[model samples]
Target: MSEKIYVPISPPTLLESDPRANLSDVERALYEEVLKHFSDSEYQIPGIEEKGRLTEAEKFWLSYECLLRYLRAVKWKSAAAAITRLESTLKWRREYGIEDIVSASHVEPEAVTGKQVLFGYDTRGRPALYLFPSRQNTDEPTRQIQMTVWMLERTIDLMGPGIETLALLINYGDKAGNPSLGVARTVLNILQDHYPERLGAALILNVPFLLNAFYKLINPFIDPVSREKMKFNPEPVKDGLFTGDMLMSEWWGGDQNFEYIHEKYWPALVGSCEARRASWLEKWRALGGKVGLKEWEYKDIDTPQVVDTKAADAKAVVDSEKISDVLTTESRVPTLAAA
Candidate 1:
């Protein structure tokens, strides 16, 4: 089987104080207070000189759900803290020129050996991202990090309405050493700081002593709250996020026999992603083509208005050796639907 249907996503993790989530009066109040902070035009950061406002484009990318993520990350208090982090991310996005990496040639070389692969989905239909340190094909830290961002952005773009996270699988196969503490810390910082509350889980496999020690050194850089989501040397099936068939086979572990051939996998992966972005952009433009639009709206997926604070709700293996199918059916709109 090339693909299997999965359950809708559960209420994404850690949504404590959002009306759109568990719809308690307390949650409604908290949601409003956070909104109030950004809803005002005169909002100001205590220590910053720039306006504490997100540009329309930035707001579009941040989405209402994303703001709630930062709020939940801070335990539903400290609107100031959440906004501060949001502002920092906006600044970083500008300085980083992240959009350029979408089609960047510099990052292409790193992915040539299929070091990073985005394929399939977990039990709740969260996109699965696989990393193989053993497949390391590059030595440049900067471009390596850019490739990480590219992969992440693609993952997010592939998320369905009820899904907001990714199932991260890191398989450090034989003799594939660990990243420098500096590189690891920088990547962790990006995930924790800019991409708050977005990791559904991190399943690490084949951890060597060196990699284990490397984790110890980077512990401080990881947020304690998010740290709990990391599972070391986990049984993917028993851990409950993935089924064997859905998991990548071979060095990664699972039922399917799959191998990554860069040429075929790359184009299929990029084509699928571009198709998704095209669909999203079309819907986004229909909805005023501006920011402040609810993600669930342009996302054009069913979601609850008021909730019980509960839950919610990919494929392609081209051949035996390629990924003809990358984005799962849920992630990509059919041409007719997109139109």
Candidate 2:
């Protein structure tokens, strides 16, 4: 059988999964309190006031999953601790201008060499992000790090109800594209602080002696949990992490000939993610709009609800109106909810 494939979302693997799952009664109560806190507060960004008015994207950002991720980061220990980290990330996002400059065009140059390709998925349907440091095209650390952050954000966009993490494939060929220790630390800090639990695995390949030494230098910066996720010289296909067609071809791999032509791959990836987000936003809006909404509701929202037009026509309510015409399934896209 083929391993599970994913694009943005490939439907939730489980019905009773999170935004908040595996919580004790107390932890569940704490989640509710955190929700209340988010609801009652107004988070102000640099140029935008996220108080009474919230755009779709803003609403999307302050989503139920986003909060739960932070709480999970702190191991559901203290609501205050989770809140502190959450607030810090919000501040960093403002300073980092997540809404303003982190876009396809802004990070386009860094991606031209196809150094970091966001392609494929693990067996759990988590998006696979492959890094080829040898192809690093820019010397500017800021843009480079921005590109990293941008990719991380893109992976989040690609996650689904039961899927909240990404598979990181690092191919440090000749260690040429390896970043400085300072840059590595900054990236690691950002991942642990802002992203927490979002890294499903970091499959490292082609570890030269220098690269192994380099990992030692930055090992302390990596949290124990993340370090646990890292595996050197992984055999993904053999281990069943990925199936043949889905893994990156020619390397660290199964059989996907994932050639990264920036012009083609970049636009497709961004556009597809945008479409997935729009689909999710539309579904969320139909249910009275919520930063309060649970992620699993997507599964609930997609439950089959067929309308009987014949029965409607027999009733006295607008008898002549063609409800069937407006409610046909002819134009519906094949959504993950159906899977």
Candidate 3:
């Protein structure tokens, strides 16, 4: 008898009526406190106002949502702690030329390896990012880090209304070669320090003993909150917080075979990224370079209640192509999530 195949199901729309509707009381308080702190002249970043790059008002509006992210990362523990974290990230971004990283003309060569892909959104509407460690191509640490950052920015652009976090799925199957431990540490630091409170869940699937041992070695370095969000090799359908149908057959232990073709996948994926970049540029121009002002004002214009139909249509096409490619190859592409 043939094995049973699970079909993915769409989850109900979970977008909040008000973006702040989901914030806890403590979170709301911290949000206001952090906003006020930044708005105060004494606490302003030195040289920001002197340089006239941004007025005090623009700076406060721009840093609004980002401050909340840091606050939530620390569980609203301390305003000082959140500001410290945010300031560090801001400095890093300035030095790293983050704006250039996001607007680069071409995707990095390392990114085309199909190692990491933004598959789809999870049931909770958070973007789902998949990492196939086996597909890692470059030994250059800088390239690895850059590729990670680029993909992260891409994933952030996919965030919709009421979606502030992302689901991470790391597949450690058919081991290629050992990944650089130092590189891994740097990547983790970036996530924990700069992108705090952005992880919804991290699922590690098909872990080999050696990798599991490495995970144990590094477990101590991970924060308690992040460590708690990790789940390993559980029944995806029952315990993984994702339906089997939403995942690839190989990783989810389902029956729908799929395979990933880099050539076919890259064009569609890159096109989607380009479209989003264009839309973002248009909005930035319209806002006169004040990107996060509305969001900071606790206004609805910052977050759209409905996902962009054009973007959604493009994603659906990519999904259809992915399914078709898998069916043609008689193997599934190791998907990490379903919409």
Candidate 4:
């Protein structure tokens, strides 16, 4: 049969009248602490237009704290198991596209821009990664770039520092066209700055137009001092053309000359990604390091009441509204009584 999937979430929402009623005293303390942290400064989220707001990094960290506790307590093991499964599904999708991939699994399919959206459990069995088939307009670089940043932050929250070696499978298709150099630079900057060790491993298929654009855009941005070592130079490259082609040329009617650089080339391109992440981290630190993000880190924040399984179905169930009120309450954290 198919593997069982579980989505991780914090305590259910409570009504305004019964917010603290459902939470244990200790749990309430934790929540307060986390909320207080967010009241500080944050960067502007790309898609979110609110000015003078907490940065996405800060929000992500807070969410991560809650997510870590929830996943560690119940779903960590299963989430790890799902990674292997994700690889398998991704491989199958690469071979046959979305229709065949979805048919092979138990996930329900949704349509986004006339393409299939395959939702599945991530390393933590949470509603983690949402895979989408290539589509027009929607999957363009603008959207993809935004999504990439958002996902990276979430990845850091879920897996923590070690997730630096994570690999992503990008479906390049004939649909939305290629992303621009600005997008690539933005993505690279985020990785190099925040998640220093995390290097992205991507498979660009279908749309070759982006290859030249990305190359040109990135070539000049290479660190001047490290230009010779860090730069990627191709032979007589052109804009909007996919020249190097997919690494798996055999599958696409080539003489297999495009083997993985790490696998077959002298550079050793194909292997565990841990080293790449490490290299990125080292280089990023060498480049003067990142600024402080005080708003993002959850220090001494109030914890939420973890509604365990038994409590989920208790006789006197609390309403979601009440839970929401507690979550939204701006009241100063009242001191705990001496016990």
TM-scores for candidates 1 onward, in order:
0.77, 0.80, 0.71, 0.30
Question: Would you list the rank order by lDDT, best first?
Answer: 2, 1, 3, 4
Q: lDDT winner among the candidates? A: 2
Query: lDDT tens string, model 3, 1-339?
Result: 234322121222334233443677777777777667665545545434444243433353244466667776776788888877776776666556566654434345776667887654544556668889899877777867877887887676556545677889888887745576787788888888888877878888888888878888777778889898898876554553543334556675543443455655554455555564455445545555442344323322332344433443233212222222221221221231211
Clashes of 1: 10
Off by over 4 Å in 3: 1-30, 36-64, 102-107, 253-258, 277-339
Q: lDDT tens string, model 1, 71-189? A: 77777666677777777787777667776534546578888887888766665656788898988877889888989998898788767665677889888876787888788888988
Q: Higher-lDDT candidate among 2 and 3?
A: 2
Candidate 1, lDDT over the whole model: 0.65
Clashing pairs in 1: 8-313, 9-312, 9-313, 10-312, 11-311, 11-312, 22-309, 314-328, 316-325, 318-324
- What is each predicted model's overall lDDT from 0 to 1? 0.65, 0.67, 0.59, 0.30
Clashing pairs in 2: 133-177
Instruction: Return whichever of 1 and 2 wins on lDDT.
Output: 2
Count steric clashes of candidate 2: 1
lDDT of 4 by residue, 241-332 (tens): 11212111222221113211111221111111233234434443444333222212221114333323233323223333322211111121
Which of 3 and 4 is the better model by lDDT?
A: 3
After superposition, the stretches of candidate 4 with alpha carbons farther than 4 Å from their true spots are 1-133, 136-145, 160-162, 207-213, 220-339
